[model samples]
Target: KKVEEQNFLIRKRVLEYDDVMNQQREIVYEYRDRILEGDDMSGTAREQLGNVVDRIAKDYLEDDFPENWDLHGLYNQLEQMYPIGIDLEELDIESVNRETLIHDLREDIVEAYGDREEELGSELMRALERFILLQIVDERWREHLQNMDYLREGIHLRGFAQIDPLVAYKNDGFEMFTELMNSIWEEFARFIYVVEVETEDHNGAGPTQPAWGSSSNTSSTAAFSYAGGTAADQPSALAAARAGGVPEEIQGAADYAYDEVEAPAHVETRVVDDKERVGRNDPCWCGSGKKFKKCHGA
Candidate 1:
């Protein structure tokens, strides 16, 4: 009874952790779906631009007089982020307040974005926007997940410091999530303004395949080795054990059988070298006891 209670508690904790991840996963998937459905992302891009401008202004203009402002340094930073040319004299800081400067900068940014859209055409610009946003979200989310996992693994150590591990985990996870959101905005702003679009073919070109999934052009086969039972049979045996239909000895045996099985190595497609061409009539390089045409070339 005590062992069963412990197992239940462990499962409950795991489910709690999974619930947090599932909520975040749903939000990301919804964003991706909107992109796939061709939702208008210009508003999102503009919002991110505002965020960038605000951050830059805070960095350079906070608690400083116009005479002491690093206009050249600010220009260099803005130039790196967007294609706009910034001239301090042209901005006429003596005549305009900081609010006006920001408003003018935003207008210039919007105009520059409009020009880029015209250059790329409407359809390609939309596609590029979707691609870039999704790519940045996915990459940053993946890194966030890794950081969360690392935090969870070490969170137990906090117990030694008289802290509750669950509480620590929750607090740290929230902080990490906030940072992730900020990073998403920054990445979107940086890429949207500076991304270069070439005149090459855009048809059938999309985001790169995710690391965990099998490629569309390849087939994956899983192979498992176990001592007591085949992979298919072990699941039913465990179910029976869990249902109390199996005796204690049988349950122990089933658990032992599962523990003895080693983890399966995932299969991936092997890359073939194609630097040198083999003539169809030439001998087979694979050393098959047959003509090239009858062997690999066939």
Candidate 2:
């Protein structure tokens, strides 16, 4: 009974951790549903592009004085991210303010995206966007789950520092989740701008495949068994005496213990000759009040 209670508590604790992952899974799935429903994603993509441009601008142009900026580095970053075709040396740095630079970069990016749409066609571009976004979200979410598992396993060690383990786990999990969200946005945007669509021989169309797989049948069972000796399987005292005490095999069987048993209401009692066999859930013959499942029967 105590073993059963402990197992129940352990399962409850596992569910608590699962709840966090379940919530994250729902958010990602909702995004996937929107894509599948053919919702417009250009607005979202534009917002993400703005964020990327802002981050790069901050890195290269970190001073009020235009002369202090690294125009070459800024150009390299923009070229790597978008298909902007402008020479840094051709521009007058003093005349090109930050607003002008941002506006020009945004125009180039928008044109690059428009070119891709023209090449792939609107329908194909929508499908590609959905595929890329879903793939990035799934891959990053899987990595995040692995990281959270590692964090949970080691979090209890924080107790040594006089901290509550649960509190530490919650805080670290939240930070990891935030990082995961950022990674999804960055990876999704990068793939969107850079993905190459391969043309197929079939009608000059791009290679296409189903985004998800078909379902399959599955089955499960609850019963469990282990190799070991039960109390009823033990040799009788007279039989043991005749065999020069318990045999090595019988003695070794003592180490194997049953970890669970049915309740008394579900068990049947019987007697054969002068000896009675004990139910697996009954109290042990060794005089311990604990259930046989956790004591000698164990």
Candidate 3:
């Protein structure tokens, strides 16, 4: 009967924990469904912009006195996320407050976003916005789930501090979910401003060069012997020869495939030329005062 009661408690605890996850799941699924249904997310984007700006205001302008605020940090935060140029000198420093700062920053950002829409065309910009939001939302939700698992695993430790474990878990979980939503929106907002689009050049007529070497017309194979070649010299020789030196009539062999192989059982040694070999008692050629036997010769 004791074992049965313990089992029931365990099952109840699991269900209670899952209830927390269920609440979060509904929020994430709503985002996914809205995106898939082709909702115009421009309003969502504007709302997120306001949220981010409000956060920046709270972070940098926590003090009532303008002099106490981190104006430089505020400028940097805005510049990094939006392409809008924020000249600190242009801002009216004497009359600045959190509300006015948020308003001006939002205005600049909205203008900058408008400029981007004009540059890319409204249709392309809309498509880019949807793609970025979808990706960030999906990715952040997965990471949030993993983080929640980690939190649940260690949450019972809070009981040692005289806090109820379930209450602590709920409070911490809510904070984490809030942060997850902020990050998803933040990245989605930033990427639309900073992403670069590359266009292909249709006028170029030359054949693309092989990646191994720069020579476009290289068609001959270069053979290298491991026994005779030093590691340092082999790379340059192979690269240079294959780059241009080989005859055009001889086609190149198959490209090299790299695989890990066991080291040879036999130990290999560099063969010293007789003229270069030092006598046992000779002064070291390295210019150390010691005899060869005690120096390199040993």
Whole-model lDDT for model 3 versus the true structure? 0.67
Residues 1-298 of candidate 3: C-alpha lDDT, one tens digit per residue: 9999999999998899899999999999888766655556777787777787778767888877777788888778778777765685466767877677777777777778788879866645555555456667777888899999999999999999999899999999999999999988776666767665333332475433211111122212111111112212222323324445344344333221112233346678998986377788888888889898898888
Instruction: Report every candidate's CA lDDT.
Output: 0.65, 0.63, 0.67
User: Which sections of candidate 1 miss by over 4 Å?
Assistant: 1-5, 64-69, 85-104, 200-298
Q: Which stretches of candidate 2 lie over 4 Å from their true place?
A: 1-17, 63-68, 85-107, 162-164, 201-298
Candidate 1 structure quality by residue, lDDT tens digits, 1-298: 9999999999999888777778777877777777656576877777667667767866776543677666677778777667774575456666657766777677777777887788866655665566566667777888899999999899999999999888888888888887787778766666666554333222457532111111122111111111222212222223222334344586799898887786576799976676246667877878876667888888
Q: Candidate 3 has which clashing residue pairs, if any?
A: none
Model 1: worst 10 consecutive residues (lDDT sum) = 217-226
Candidate 1, residue 295: CA error in Å?
47
Best by TM-score: 3
What is the clash count for each candidate, in the order shown? 0, 2, 0
Candidate rank order under lDDT: 3, 1, 2
Q: Compare candidates 1 and 2 on lDDT and give the better one.
A: 1
Q: Please give the lDDT score at residue 267 for candidate 3.
A: 75
Model with the higher TM-score, candidate 1 or 2: 1
Which ten-residue region of model 3 has the weakest summed lDDT?
219-228
